[model samples]
Target: MVAVRRGDVVVANLDPTIGVEIKKTRPVIVVSNDSINQLSQLVVVVPLTKNIAHLSPSHALIPKGVARLTFASKAVTEQIKAVDKRRLVKRLGILPPALLTQVERALKNTLAFP
Candidate 1:
């Protein structure tokens, strides 16, 4: 299995949903600590959306083509989740450290964690 490290933009299978589901196989950023990611069967991730409306600290916009992405996307901190590593389809690219730090901050704010 490929190692999933923090900051990796990965494709995942996110189907079989319930209400307000993010749905479908999509791009997600691995937000878990690298140590835990190496040892656990599941990895934490934040989903991305193309929607740019109502941007806030909780929603950091990733510039177009960052990590070779085709379009700009917003990291939906509100939609953070964890899933089996098997759900990861492919690693797209690593997000730059500085932006990832912004994501971590947003995650903290969204989750109300200290």
Candidate 2:
């Protein structure tokens, strides 16, 4: 039996003494949108922390730090779109050149942003 059911949000608890860390359980949701499909698929959001180890190869890495963002989900794209719309409205009164440059850089590095 699973202690946590659907729609439950969890967090990670790091324990160095035991060399064990508690991690958040990804949430799964079943969407029934006719536009998508008739069958419901499980959408999971796996939260991850920024890997400081990847920043440098020689440095001693610690996994004690939690992720800056609270949750990671398929909803990220929508969230990003919403944020961008707000940014466009609030800053520059148009799509800022700096924002576009950052987005281009992100695409060059990861091929995806959001």
Candidate 3:
């Protein structure tokens, strides 16, 4: 597969090495900078979970039927992590540029920036 860009939703293998884990295969959004993604073997991603209750400002709800997901999912900003590009299995679809901007803003908030 080609390099994934920001806002692109893809199926990812999230098997953990140890400890409490949100492991296994799941849908994730590529949230890394495009330039870095082009050069690095790893990219940052946010896992998408079906749980959508009490979403914080940092969590963006991906509505049902969007992309390859049959049900609504929340992009759990707090659970963001970097994974090998190989972990990304298949490309589902790309979220809109506007929504990506909102995601970026949410990330900034989640990460605590001025």
Q: lDDT of each model, Cα atoms only?
A: 0.87, 0.23, 0.85
Cα shift from native, residue 51, model 2 (Å): 3.6
Question: Which runs of model 3 end up more than 4 angstroms from their true locations?
Answer: none
lDDT (tens digit, per residue) of candidate 3 on 14-100: 996477556789998899989978999999998888989998988888888777787798888878899998888998899878767
**lDDT tens digits by residue: candidate 2, 22-79:** 2222221211123322222322222223343343211222122112223222211111
**Candidate achieving higher TM-score, 1 or 2:** 1
Residue 68 local lDDT, model 2: 24
Candidates in order, TM-scores: namely 0.93, 0.18, 0.89
Off by over 4 Å in 2: 1-23, 26-41, 44-46, 55-114
Using lDDT as the measure, which candidate wins?
Answer: 1
After aligning candidate 3 to the native by TM-score, how far in Å is the CA of 110 from where it should be? 1.0
Count of clashes, each model: 0, 0, 0
Quick one: best TM-score, which candidate? 1
Model 3 TM: 0.89
Clashing residue pairs, candidate 3? none
Q: Output the lDDT of residue 59, model 2.
A: 22
How high is the lDDT of residue 91 in model 1? 88
